[model samples]
Target: MSEQADLKRTPLWDAHRRLGARMVPFGGWDMPVQYATGILAEAKAVRTTAGLFDVSHMGRLEVHGPTAREALESLTPNVIGKLALKKGHYTLFLNERGGVIDDLIVYCQEPNLYKLIVNASNTEKDCAWIQSHLPAGSVLTNRTPDTALLALQGPLAVTIMAAAGAPEASEIRRFERVAVRLFNNPAWAMRTGYTGEDGFEIQCSATSAENLWNALLRVAGPNLVPCGLGARDVLRIEAAYPLYGHEIDDDCNPWEAGLGWVLKKTEGFIGAEALARLKESQARQLVGLTMETRSVARQGATVLAGDRPCGEVVSGTFSPNVNASIALAYVDRDVTDETLTVESGGRRQNAARTPLPFVDLPVARKKKPAGLTSTASL
Candidate 1:
C-alpha cells in the first residue's frame, strides 16, 4: 500500500481473491465487482434470498464532543436535532450552493459521539469538510482503516442473523443500531441496507471481520451468495435509491435529485438559504422513466420532450426483476404524463413516466419474532 497511489486496499482484499472474485479498481481501492456467479445471478439471489457484501472499502469516521450534532448540522441536511442516541440516518453533505457533496449515514453512538459512514471515494474530502466546520469543542477522528463493514441482505437475512445467535438482531428496527456479540466478538449491527430488502449492516473490528464473514457464509450456506459492486449497483437502481456521483453531485441540489424530503426547512442549517431559493425557482424535477421498447437507457443519455431536449438520464439499468429497461432522470417539471423519447445507442426510443420501484415486494408483511421489530425498520 503506497501512501500516494490514490488507491487503498481493504482488509478483505486477500479473502476476495481467494473466493475467485474479479477484482477491479473502485474509488482507488481494489474491489470485487462480482464473483464467479456473475452480477445477474447475484442480483436475483438478493431479491429472492440473501446476499452478502464486503463493504469494508467504505469510510468510517468518529466525531466526539459536546457539540457533535451541532457541528454536523452545519455540514449536512438531515435534522440531527431529533436523532436519538444509538440511532442512524441517511444524510447528505451540501455545498454553499445547496449542491450535494456526498451522501452519508450518520450514527449517533452517544449523546456526544457520532460515527459517519461515507462513500469510499469521498473519504478524504468529506473528512476535510467536516473537520473544517467543527466547533471549538468537537473532535473528529478517522476510523476507516480500523473498521470493516459487512452487509447481509435479502428476504431471509433475518433468519441468518438469528441463527448466528444475534438475539438483538431481530429487535433492531430499520435505520437502528444495536451493539451485539456475533461469533463471540463485539459488533455494531445496524438494521439497514441499500438492496431495498430486509438486512443488516454489521460494523466490526478489521481484525475479526474475516472471522465473522466466514461464519456468516457458513451459516447461510448455499442461500447466502457473496455479492459484489455489480449486483449492488443493479439492486440499488431497481429500488430507485440515488447514487452519489451519478444521480447527484456537487453540481446538483437535493430538490433536483428527488431528495427534497430529507431537508427540514424549519431547522436553519448550512445551504438552507440557497435551498429555499432553489425550491422557489423549482425549474426541474427528478422522475422515473420506463422505456417503451427493449432498449436500455443509460447514464448521460439525452431525454427529449417532443423535439426539444429537456434533461439527461442520471442512473439507469435494465431491471432484472422487472424484466424491462428502466431509468431515472432529471426532466423539466412540465413533462407530466406526456410520452417522451430517450436517445440511446444512436437511436431514439419511446419512454413513459412511471412510478419508482418498478418491482415491488411484499416481504415486509412476513411475520417474525416480537423482539425483531428493530430489524424490520431497516
Candidate 2:
C-alpha cells in the first residue's frame, strides 16, 4: 500500500487541510506542521492571545474493571490511588530498570476506572506493555479511534473557551475534568495543557470534531489562531516540556530527565526499587541552555564544556517568546561549568545554564471557586 494511504487521518483532517495547513507525517498520522500564518505567527497567537490545536493524533486509552487501580499503580511510579474523582495527574510509565516507557496523564473518572492519554507513537506499544502487566479482573481498551482531543491554549484560552460555549471551563481547576457543553455538544474539558500556559484539553466524540472546530473558530473570530504541530513544538520547547522521542524514551529515567517531581514518594510503584537505587552522583541530569545567538541546536547535538563533550541536546529551537535560541540537554552530573557550548550541524554556539522554563507562563488560567484547590498549588 502507498505510504499516504497507510497514514491515519484524524476526524478533523479535512478541516486542517481546508485551513491551508502544511501536512506532514507524524507518528504514522497525516498531521499539519503549520498553517499559512506560519509557525511564528501561530506561536505568537498562543502566547499573546489564544490558539486552538487539533491534537486528535494522540492516543486515549481507558482502563476499567475492578483491578484497574492496582494494575495501573504497578505500571507507573506515581501513586495512582491518590487521584481524586474527576482529577488527574501527570506520570511516567516505567520499566523495572527505572526507564520510562512513556510519560502520560492519567485521569480518574470513577472507582476502578482511568483514562490515560499516551503519546500517539507509543499507543500500541504502551497498550501491549500495560496488558502484559495487568492482573486478572483488569481490562484495557483503546479509545483513540472514537475520541478527538482539542487543546485551546494561551493566556486568553479560558476567556475564548467561555465565549465559545463552555463557560464552566473557567471554573475547572487545574488537573480537574468536568462535563460541559462545547459548541452545543456534550464533551469533557480538562484544565491541563503542555504549553505551560493556561488552557483546556477538551475531549469530544470524533463525530463532533469538525463542527466543533468550525464553531470554535466562528465564535473566537480573529482572537483564536488554528495552530499546527510546528507552533505546538515551539510552544512546548519554550516551556521545557519533554517530547517522547526527543527528551524522553525507554532508556531515559526520571532522575536523569528532571522528572523526579512526579513521584510523591518512590516506594510502592513498579520502578520504585530501581528508582530508589538511583543517586544524584550517578545521574546524567537534564538542564536548560540559553544560546548567545539565534543559532538553533537540533536534537543529537553535542554539548561541550570547554573542549570536552559532556552531553547531548535533546530538544532545541529559536523561542519566539524569548527572541533567542534555547535548548534542553542531558548533561553529565560531574560537569559543573556554567558556560557550555552546543555544536549542531558543525556550528558551535556558546550557551549558558538557564532554568528549566525559558518562559514564565501562568499555571492556572482562571481562579477556581473558594473550595477548589489548584493542582499548581500542589
Candidate 3:
C-alpha cells in the first residue's frame, strides 16, 4: 500500500478500488497489481479473450515545432526521418555509454509533431534529458498528468472496440495510430500493445476516463475483464519484451539484450558510436529458456552448467498458456544456443535455450510489398 502523500494516483484509481483490486506501489504510484480474479486468471483472460489495463501510469510527452523531428532523431537510435505520419515504433533512450535509459514508443503524429510514450518510473528523468537536448525551435510538453491510457488486448479486442463505437479500430494496422472521438470525447487509438496480443491502446483526457472506462466495460461486457500489473508483467515476459530494470539498465546496451535490430549505426545518434563498438565486443546475450521441471526459475536465479555459473534469470513465470515454466536470461555469448540448468526450489532443473517470444504474437508482421523499402513496417 503506497499511502504516502507523494505517491501518484491515476484517474482510474477509484474504479480499480471499486472493483476490488489489490493495490501496491509501482513506479511511485498506488497501482493495482491484481484484481479479484487474480494474476493468473487475468493473464489467461488476455491470452484467450480480452483484458483491459489501466496504463495511465505511463508518461506521455508531446514534442512539436520546427526542429522537433531532427532533435528527436538525434536523441534516439531509430531513424525518425523514415517514420511516416501516424506510424510509431519501439525505441530506446540511451546514455552516452550505450546504456539504456528507457525503452519507449515514439509516434509521429504530423509533419512536425510527435508523441513519446515512456515508462512511468523514469518519466521525470526522461523529461529532463529531453529538455537538455531540446533543439532551438522545438517545444516539449509533459501530458502525463492530464491523460489516461487504456490497453484493450487479446483476440477479441477489435470486437470490443467496435462495440464501444470505434468502428475505425479495425482499419488501424499494427504500429499505426488514428485520432478519433470515443464516447463523445476526443481520443487517440493506436494499434499497439505491451501484451503479445492484437490490441489497441486508447489515450484520452483524465476528466473523461471514468465515463470512457464505464462505457467500454458496458460495451465489452463479459468478454473483457480488468487486468493489473501482475498479469501485465507475466504477459510481457512471456512475449519476451524486456522490462527496464529486469533485462536492461544503465549498464546494459541494446546488443546484449537481443534488440540490435532497432539500432541503426548509420543514424549517428547519441549512443551510436559506443553501441557500434560494443556490438563488436558484446559478451552476453539475452535468450529465452524453458525449464524441464515444473519449478519456476525466478529473477536473479543463477543459471549453471554442471557446477559453474554461466548466467542468471532476468524474468520468469509459470506460463498458463504454455503449460510450462519459462524465463528470459542473459548468458555469456559463447554459452547461448545451448541447454543449461537453474536452481529452483533447492533443485537443479534442466533448461533449454529457446528462441525469443515464447508465444507467437497475435498479429503477424505485415510483409512488405515485393521490392518496396521496409520503412512502413519498422
lDDT of 3 at 75: 90
Q: Per-residue lDDT tens digits of candidate 3, residues 1-378?
A: 336667899999999999999998899888999999989899999989999999999999999998999989999988888999999999999899999999999999998999999999989999999999998999999999999999999999988877877877887978898987777678999999999899999999999998898888888888899999999998998899989999999899998987888886444678877876787898888989999976889999999876788889999998877888999998888874478989856779899888879888766556568568566334
Model 3 steric clash pairs: none
lDDT of 2: 0.88
For residue 110, what is the lDDT in candidate 2?
96
Global Cα lDDT for candidate 1: 0.86
Which wins on lDDT, candidate 1 or candidate 2? Answer: 2
TM-score of each: 0.92, 0.95, 0.94
For residue 280, model 3's alpha carbon misses the true position, in angstroms, by 1.1
The sequence of per-residue lDDT tens digits that candidate 1 reaches over residues 254-310 is 887778878864446778888877777777777888888767798999999987899
Q: Give each model's whole-structure lDDT.
A: 0.86, 0.88, 0.89
TM-score of 2: 0.95
Clashing pairs in 2: none
lDDT of 3: 0.89
Off by over 4 Å in 3: 1-3, 344-346, 365-378
Q: Rank the candidates by lDDT, best first.
A: 3, 2, 1
List ranges where model 1 is wrong by over 4 Å: 1-6, 361-378
Give the number of the best model, judged by TM-score: 2
